[model samples]
Target: MPEPPPLTNHGKTMTSVFSLLGRNENDLTAALGWTLRSSPKFLAALTGALSPAPQARTTRIDLEVSDQLGRTDLELHGADHAIVIEAKRGWLLPTVTQLETYASRCGSAPIAHLVTLSDCSPDWAQMHLPAIVGEVKVTHLPWSVVGERLASARRTSAGHERLWLDQLDIYLKEALRVVEVNNAEAYCVVISNDRPGGGGPHTYREIVEQGYYYYPYGWGRGWPAIPPNFLAFRWEGYVQRVHRVLDYEVIPSLQDRWPDIPVLSESSGDRARSDVTDRPHVLCRLGPALRMDPLPTGINYRANRLWVLLDQLYTAPTLQAAQRESQVLRGDAVADESASI
Candidate 1:
């Protein structure tokens, strides 16, 4: 667990809860430059990507070296190579003319990289820039890719540098909605039915009609860790069939407004607790559902938890697959509906 920050920096309420990236785009870029300058391995990786080169030596590493002409966001200069970076945050896309302006001023630099949080590359960025900029090979980087690099660097960093990199990593993870899972790549998660034989809140029929699903996180059960971006729904005691998969976001019930999702009350002998929302509930915007035909036999009901790996479940290519599976499951559920007339 993270230690609570000093509540008051000299008898005042702490205003900037987040560090560099949270403040603004300029700060994020500047921080990146600072981090790269401190780490020789990262600096070499950035330079090598632009063009072929030998191993970069830390002795020659230079950050923000004399960009008086272009005023680029960052400049990593070395003895025989250099890279000029124009960093962007959020949806701010650089135009062809703007890139051209920067490239022109780079003065025969080995690489001119236009990095942004998203893919804002129009045709001209890829097709026209290389020809116009001459020797400067142009490239685009999404925050996701950059976040991967930061994560790698963090592992080898030390002391204050590692702390700063960790802060930047936090910002990237939040913005990118990527989760670190099972010592593997940062990926999404899937929710498994607590009861292996099905019969749970938000059934297949319900999920198909609703377009979204919500499950309270950490409800004192052995729930698996939730991923950063998406969620998948799986039925236990069955052949790895994924009924639905959707991109999801976490909503803090205490601090943030609840999502406007349909609430259905389906409890036995009591008023349903639909309206009493919980904090850190995952709301998955429903997507494709897949079914496993000819259900495998000899399956055992084990865990009473819902955390599942997203890739392990099977996803159907079409709604027909979901419909076909739902019909079968719904029939079984109806037969088991003891309250029916």
Candidate 2:
């Protein structure tokens, strides 16, 4: 249990809530970046083709194959130079025998691997592998930190905190598991939170100006000043409308009208479309002291929206608008921030 926040404002995480705990590596891996679904073929292809660069730039190969017996749990294609993976959140540790079986079939020169949602000590795995597969690598990914980060973001953003929470619940309860093996160095890369002209007049414009990857709905890379991904709008509802054209500003009126409105989710879709479903939307803004203070109840309210309100909205206009407002001026707000709307 975390202690109540200190009045002195150190702004540190309440260490009690983050003490030593058992972990699942696969979940964390998926939470950090990708979610592998569909078939073993898809997981393998995603790993085989994922680009090492910050900007993704590669066409992935498909490694699904069928055997005379039935659908092969894993597949590899020789010409494509790819590997396939099959997942079972059930096992304590995944085995190399699984990898060798796929390698033997594909006859590809590239190294093949196995991924699992659960894991054991590497020593336990070494104890079980047979000669034919002993050398084949088996990557055991745990979902601990990745899940925690995604969950925390969902529960804390100002814009769509509720929706993000909902989306997060879906992720937690689902049968989903992913394996993100990279030839490139892998890290959970969140952009530097300090962006100029961040929090805008209509949204969390001020905080976004500083460096804090956060916002109402979990949009964009959220630099605390503004949203991470785009200007605040989702397909189902107006994200930042004043409380009531009849009365309040978009943020407050939205709450007055529909207290049940959902928060946002920070996750994205395969197409990289900005309008991913269940991303957050606004409910209401909070007082300044509450807004900046870590572990504030309202912070969770906003974080909920980022991922929950991942619905698609028109991207072109919003992108255009964000650019016009933030470019080339030493604004009371950040310059070059207009490109973000």
Most TM-score-accurate candidate: 1
Report lDDT (Cα) of residue 53, candidate 1: 51
lDDT of each: 0.45, 0.32
TM-score list, all predictions: 0.44, 0.27
lDDT by residue for model 1 (1-341), tens:
99777656556544332442344556666667766766665655555544345344533323343444445566555544455566664423565565665665445534334433342333323433443444455676656567667767778878876776776666555533324333221122233423211232544335433565555543424333343333433343344333343455445441233233333223333533323343345555665554445222122323222222333223433322332344454453322211211
TM-score of 1: 0.44
Candidate 1, residue 60: how far the Cα is off, in Å: 8.4
For all predictions, the C-alpha RMSD in Å is 17.5, 20.9
Instruction: List the candidate 2 regions with Cα displacement exceeding 4 Å.
Output: 1-58, 61-64, 69-81, 92-98, 119-123, 130-135, 143-169, 173-341
Which of the numbered candidates is closest to the native, going by highest lDDT? 1
* Residue range with the least summed lDDT across 10 consecutive positions in model 1: 332-341
lDDT of 1 at 194: 32
